[model samples]
Target: MKKILLLSACLSIIPGTTLAQNTTAGTIELDMPGHFQRQSVSFDYVRRDVMIPMRDGVKLHTVILVPKDARNAPILMTRTPYNADHMTSFASSGDMSSVLEGYDNMTDVIADGGYIRVVQDVRGKYRSEGRYVMNRPFRGPLNGTQVDHATDTWDTIEWLVHNTPESNGKVGIIGISYDGFTALTALFHPHPALKVSVPMNPMVDGWIGDDWFHNGAFREENLPYIYDQDATPKNDEKWWSNHYDAYDLYLNAVSAGALGKSRGMEQIGFFRQITAHLAYDSWWQNQAMDKLLVKEGLTVPTLLVHSLWDQEDSYGAVATWYALENVPTSARNLSIVIGPWNHGGERVEASKLGDIKFRADTGYYFRKKILEPFLAHYLKDSTISLPARVSEFRTGENIWETASKLPAPDCASECKALHLEPGHGLGFTIPGVDAGAAQYTSDPDHPVPYVPRPVLTKGVTGSPWKYWLVTDQRDVASRPDVLTFTSEILTKPLTIEGEPLVHLTASTTGTDGDFVVKLIDVFPDQVSAQPEMGGYQLMVSADILRGRYRKSFEHPEAIPANTPQLYKIALPFTNHTFLPGHKIMVQIQSSWFPLYDRNPQSYVDNIFFAPKAAYKPATISVDIRNSWIDLHTK
Candidate 1:
C-alpha cells in the first residue's frame, strides 16, 4: 500500500493530473532517472528575448522561457555575466517550437516539462546594456533611487513578476560563480516577489577567495580569458594559453607584469590590478561579500550549494555559509549542500571524480533528491522537506549526512592536533617533538607542479578542468622540495567532517615566498581488493599561503629573513574517512606551478611588477614547535 501511494504521488505530479499530492513540505521520490524519460516528454516553453530595464534605466538582456501549458507557474531565474549569445539564437531564428538540445540539459530535470525558467545576461556582458563592474558591491540601504546589483536584482524581480504573463507573482533566483554573486546581491535588496535565492560557489571576496584569487595569490585560470580585452572579434574564445605546458609557461613568467607583456598576455588588465593590491584593502573590502553579509544580514531564505573539492570557490562556499554562524541554527534561513564534487559537481553525474569512483551516482542523487526538491518547494510551493540547514556528503564512507549545523554539533567532533614528529612521523603530541626543524631549498626554476603533468592534458584535449584534488600525489611525494610527514596505520576508521587547517612554524631565507600544504590519505602499500589502489595517495584538503601575508592579508610585509614565522594555511571544506589500515599524510611544498603564479622569493613592493631578475631560490625551514594541522573529525 505504501509503495502504491508513493507511485500515485509521483503520477499526480505529472501535468494534467488532479490526484492531489502534498507538495508544500516532506517528499521522498524514487531516485530513478530512467522513469523520468518515458516518451521523452518533451515540453515547450515559449522563449522570449526582451530587454529588462534596471531602476537606473540600463536595459539588460533577459530570456524568458515560460511553459505554455502551465499557467501561473512559479518563475525560476539565473542571471549571468558570461555571454548569453547562444540563448539569443532561440528567439532570433523564430524556431521556438524546436527543442533546445543544449539548454534542455538543465530544463529536462529542473523544468520538469514546465516551470517558468528565465535566464538573463547581467549588465555589461554579451548583449546586455550597462557598464559591467566585475563583482559589483552590494549597496547597503539604497536611498530609493540608488542603483547597484542589489537594486538591479530587486527591480528585475519586480519587472519579471508583472511582465511575464504566467509568472505566479513569485520569483526565485539562482546562479553559479559570478551569477551566484548576483543572486546573493538580490538578498540584500529583495523584491516582494523574490522569495528565495541559491548562490552556488559565488565570489565572496576578490582579495581572498573565489576565482580571481585564493587568499592573496592570483589564480591563473580566468586570466587567459579575461586578458587585457585584446581578444578581438576575429580571435576565438580560447582563453587559456595555447602552449602544451601552460603550467610551465606561467611559472616562467615569475611576475604578472612579465606574463602580461609577453605573448599578448598584456591584454589582460586584471593582471595589473592583482599586483597593485597584495592586501585586503579598500579595492577588495568594498566588494567583500562577507562584510556586506555581516552588515546587511541575509534576509531571504537561501540555499548554498558547493562541492567539498570545488577547485575555485571552496573558500567562498565555506566562508559564506559559516559567516551566518552567529545566527541560531533553527532561525537561520541559510542552508547548505556540500557534495564530493569539483567546482560544479552538482551538475555532474556525481558517482565518480576522475579515477576515484564515489560508488554511487552522487550527481543524480543531488539533482533528483536535493536540487529538484529545494527549487520546487520554494518556487512552486511543492510539498517537500527542504534539506537540513547543513547537508554534507561524506567521502571514503560514501553517504550524505544532515544535521542542525555543519562540523556536526555532535560530541565526537573537535579540533584534534596531528603533531609533526622527527623522522617524518605524524602522531598525537609527544613530550619534545621539536628536535630542530625540517628544511629544504625552494628553487623557482624547479617549482612543483600542482598536479602530475600527464593529468593536466585538459589543455590539449579541450576537456574541462576538474578533480585536481583527487589526483594521485605519488609522483611528487618524493620530491626534494616537498616535506612529507606520515602517521601510523589507523586501527579503525577515522572519519572527519568540516574544514581542516594546517598551521606551520617556518622561516624562509628570502623575504617573500609561498608555503603549499596538502592533507593526504595514503592507502596501504599492499591492497588485496584493488591492487591498483595500492599506495594511492589522495589529496583530501590543501592550501597555500604567501609568506609575506603571514601577519595580515591586507597589509602584506616582507618576512624577516631567518625569523620563524607562523603561517596558517586553512584548507577548504572536506568530509572523508581515513579507513583502518590507511595512513594519514601531510605534504608541504613551496610552489604550485601555473595553477597559482609563483611567488618571487625576493620581496618587492608588488610581486607582479617584479622583473624576472627578482625570481630567486631560497631555503625554507619548518620548525617543530607548535607546527601541526588541526583536523576536525568524528
Candidate 2:
C-alpha cells in the first residue's frame, strides 16, 4: 500500500513514497503544511469516480476532473498500472468545493490549456477489475473478443468522448515509464478523439534493455523491484530484504533462482513466468512496444522525452525511436528530446549529474519549453511550434543541438576505433604490436561492487541504485579485478556524439562469464582538490554482454575456455565531448555486483538454475593488441 500523508504541521511523509512516474532521478514531494495548510491544489473543478467498461467487460476505475467554469476542452488521458489514486490530489468531501491532489497534478496545465483530465487504472491493477498481465502484448486485428492494452485504451477513450461533460472531441494522452509504455500502446489504435501522445521514457522492452533484463543478464534489482510493485496482494511490505547489505544477500544466494526461491517467488506469478523464459523467446519479443507499433503504425503525433543517463529506460527510448523509421513520415509522426538526466530526471533538476555540472537547468527547459509547447500546439491549437526532430544536450560542452534525426547520419562515417594501447593507454594511433594481455581473476565470492559503498540501498522510493549511473569510479580504478585503460590528455577536444561500443578480444578460464565494459572520462589531476570534483572518473557509457548469449539471445552457448573470442557490447547512446585536458578511459571487469547478478562462471543452459557451488574464480584475459573501443567521435 502507498504510504499516505495528510496535510499537517510538524510532520512530513515524503521520504519513502514513490510516485506513478517511477523516476530514478528523485522522488516527488507533496509539500505538507503550506501557509494555508490546504489539503490539495486549489482549482475550481468537479471531481467524480467512474467505472468505465472495457470491450472485454472489465470495469476500469477512473478519475475525471472537469473545471467548473469549463467550456469545450481537449480530454487528456493516461492509463497507469501504478494506480490512479496518485493522480488525485484529494477525495470528495461534504463540501463539494474542496480540491483534491492527484498523480496527474497538471491542474495548472489543465487550467491554462483548457483540458478535461482523466486518469485510469489499467485492468487487474489496484481498483481495476480484470486479470493483470504486465507488459501485455498488443492483440492486433482485434475481433470483438480479443483484448489488450490497445483495446482497453481505445474503449476507454470511446466512452469518455460521449459520456464526459464539457469534453471536446479532441483527446491527448501522456505518461512516463510504465505509464509511458501504456501510452505507447494506445497509439496503435488511437480513437478518433485521440490526437497526441507523449510517452516519455517508456519501458519498451524487458528482455533486451529497460526494466527487467539487460543483454540477457537478469537484473539483480528485480527481486526488490517486484516486491515494491505488487507486494500487498501477498500481505508483504515493499522491501523483501531484512538485511542492510542487499548485495551480500543476493551474492550469498548465488543463482538468480536461489534468490527468487529464498524470497518465496513461487507465490509470485510474474517471477515464475520470468524465470521460466530465460531466453528472449516469443513471449518477450511479442511484448516489445516497437514490434507492436510496427503492426498498427503510429497514426498520431508522438513526443518522446528521454534522459541521456536514464538509469532505467534509455534503451527503450532509442529503440522505439528507430522502430518508427519503418513507417511513413506522415503516419508515424515522431519527435524526441534527449537531455542530461537519470531515468525521468529530465523533468527534475538536471543542471548537474554527480559532481559534473551541465551549467543549465535542463529539466526546467524540457518541461516549460519543450513539453508545454508540444501539448499546446497539438491539443490546444496554439501557434507555438514544436522543437526540431531531435534535440540532444551535449554534456562536456554543455549545449543543445538539433538534427533531422538522432546520431545525425553523418556520424556513421565519423566512427573511429580507439585501440587499447600498451601500459594502460588509449589512443587512435596504433603502437608496435603487443602480445601480452591484461589478466584478472574474477571471484564470485568477492565480486566487484558497482559503487564504492559496501551496502546496497534498496527501495523504489529512494534507492542508491537510482544514482549509480552517475557515481564516481575512482574507488574501483585501483582494484586488481578491474582493468583501466586511459588515453593521454588531449591537445584538442574530442567530441563523442553518438553510440559507443566495446569490442573485447578475450576469453575466460571458466565456461560462462559476463563482460562489463565501461567508457569513462578521467578528470585532470588539478581538479582533485574539491571532494566531489576531485579527479573524478565519470562513467559516460557502459553495458554488459553475457558470454552465453554472445552467440544468440535465443540460443545459449558456452564460451570455449582459454580461447580468444570477439564480444561486441553496445554501450548506451551518449553525447559528450572529451575536453582538452581530460583523458578518455575504458574500464573492463567481469562482474558488477548488485546491479547485475553474479555469473556462476560454470556452463549451464540457464544461469538462473545454476547453484552457488558452480561459481568459481575465473582468470579473464583481454588482448591489448586485438581489442579496441569504437567511440563515435566527431
Candidate 3:
C-alpha cells in the first residue's frame, strides 16, 4: 500500500501534470520525483514557507518542504543566505539555477528515502529577522564579530527537532558555497542530532584566500562583483538588475581584450567601503574557520567536495581540509572529492553553458550514483560500503579511481628541482646548472589578464566551458614580463600530496613585489589532449603570494632594493599524481592581471591609491642561494 501510494504520487509530478495547487502563503506547489516503485524509485514533494527561531531571541524566515508522506523522519538541513523561495520554486519549475536547486525539493526525495528536508535563511538575511552579519560571527557577548552562524544553526536545529513533529531526532547538513560554510560551522558544535556534513566549495577562510583575496593579493575583478551582488538590496530586482548590467559590461570588456575598461573602476568606491578594513584585522580574522575548527572542534563525519577550477573558493577548501585532517580527533572523518568541473560544474556540463559539446549528464551520474548513495548509506545506517581514502574523478582519463591513499611516484629528492635557464624556455636539468634567473617588470597599469576560458567566470550558472589541456606557460614565458622555469621529465609518476612551499631569497627594486608560482604537469608532446568526458581542465595546480605579507599578514614593510630577504610562501596544496613521461613545470611571475590587483612599484600606503604615474617598471632579482619550492612527494 505504501509502495502504491508513492508510485501514484510520483506519477502526478510527471512532465505534464495538472496538479498545480496554491497555498495560503502564495506558494505554488508541484509534485517532484518520489521514491522507488516496483522496479525503479521516484520522488515527489511539496514546498512551503515557515519561520525558524534563533537562540538570540530572533525569528528567521525559512522555506520548508517535506515528502508528501514524510513524518517522524530524520531531517536533512540546509541553511543559506540565498533566497530559499527562489531556489525552491526554481527547482520545482525544473529550471536549475544552482546545484542545490536541482535538489530544492529535498524534502520529498529524502522523505521518499525516509528523511525530512529543511532549508532556512540565516539570521539577518532575506526573510529572516535580526541584522544580517556578512561573514562576521558574534563571539561571546557583543564583544566580537556581529554574528556567528554556527550558533544560529544550533538554535535552528534545536527548534526543529522539538517543534516539528515526526522528526526522528537525527540531522544531517548539506550546502554549497556560502551555505556550505554554514554547514561546516554547524559541525563546530555538533548537535547530538547532527551526524553527517557535506560542505561543497565552503568558504572556510575569509581573510587570506577566498573569493575576496588570493595568496594575499586581492581578486580585484570578482571580489567587487560579489560584494555588489550580495550586499546590495534585493527588495526589488533593481540592485540585481544593475549588478547584472555591470557584470555584462565587465564580461564584454574581457571578451574585447579590454579588461580594466569595465564599470569596475566606477565601483571602486563601493569596493573600498566593503573592504575598507583591508588588513587581516579582527573583523576578517574572526571568520577564519581554521581557528574556529580548532576552538570548537568537529564531532561528525565530513565530506569535503571541491572542483579544481573553482576560481573563487578553491584555496580555502584545500587549506581547511589539510588543517582539519591534521587536528587529532576521533569523531572527525575527513574525505575529499575533486573533479575537473568549475564551481557549479558538478551539477551541469560546462560545454552546454558555452554552446560547446560534450558527454551527456555528468551531473546526474554524480548525484544519483555517488552523492545519493553516500547520503543514503550514512543517514539510514544502511549496509552499503564506503571507500576509505579518496574517490577522485580524473579529468584527462575520464574515469573514477579510488585509492587507499593519494597516488605518488617513486623518486628521490635529488631528482626534484628543475632549472629555468635564461634562453632555454622550460626543461628539466640539474639545480646548480648555472641557468641564470629570468627577469620581468610587473606594471600595475597593464596587469596581465587571467587566461580567458569560456566558463572561468560563470558565477553560479552551471554552464559547460571549454577545458584546456595541460596549461601552456609558454605564453607567460614568451612575454617579456614573466619568468619560466621547468624540470626534467619524471622517469616515474610523481605524486604531490601535501602543501607546497616556495622558499626564496630575493631583493626587489620596489617596496613590494608579488610572486606567483604555477605547478604544471608538462605533457611529453607540446600538444596535449582533453577527453570529452566533461568540462574538466588538465592542469594540476597553481598558486600566488604577495611579498609584503610574507613575514606577517598584519604588518607590512618595504624591502631594501639591493639586500636580499628570505621570503617563504606556501602554495595551495594538491593531491595530484603526476604521470610518468610528464615533466614538472613551475612558472614564476609577478602579475596575474585583473584576477589580482596589481602592486605598485612605489611603496605606498595602499595599492588602490597608487597612481598610474607611480607604476614604474622595476627589476626583481631572485638569489639562488636558498631559493626552491619544496613539494611533498610519496
Q: What is candidate 3's lDDT per residue for 23-141, written digit by digit as tens? A: 55556665665764332123354445778766667888876655556666678888877766665665323212221344323322353465566778777667778765556464663
Candidate 3 lDDT score at position 28: 67
| Tens-digit per-residue lDDT, 1-634, candidate 1 | 9999999889878887753254533655545776562232343556677898887789988888676566878887878765555633443232233333233224445456366767787776777887655565555331223678877777778888889878678788877777777888888757878878888877787667677777777775556645523243223445555556766567656655567666565544445556566787887777778667876777778888888777777777677776776756413788888888887667656788887777898877877877677777777757887867777789888888887777632223367888888888888775294367899999888789877673253345644367777888998898999999999999999987777777799988999999888899999998786788899999998888888888898788898999999998778778899999899999999988777777879988877677778889999998975688887878
Query: What tens digits encode model 2's per-residue C-alpha lDDT throughout 110-218?
Result: 5456677788988878788987766766663322248888889999999998897686678889888888898898887678888898888898998888888888888
Clashes of 3: 23
Q: Roughly what TM-score does model 1 have, to 2 decimal places?
A: 0.86
Ranking by TM-score: 2, 1, 3
| TM-score on alpha carbons, each prediction | 0.86, 0.88, 0.77
- Model 1 RMSD in Å is 14.0
Q: Candidate 3: TM-score?
A: 0.77
Off by over 4 Å in 3: 1-43, 91-114, 141-147, 233-274, 349-370, 393-415, 418-430, 452-475, 487-492, 524-538, 580-582, 624-626
RMSD of model 2, in Å?
10.6
Ranking by lDDT: 2, 1, 3
Q: Best-fitting candidate, measured by TM-score?
A: 2
The stretch of ten residues in a row with the least summed lDDT in candidate 1 is 95-104
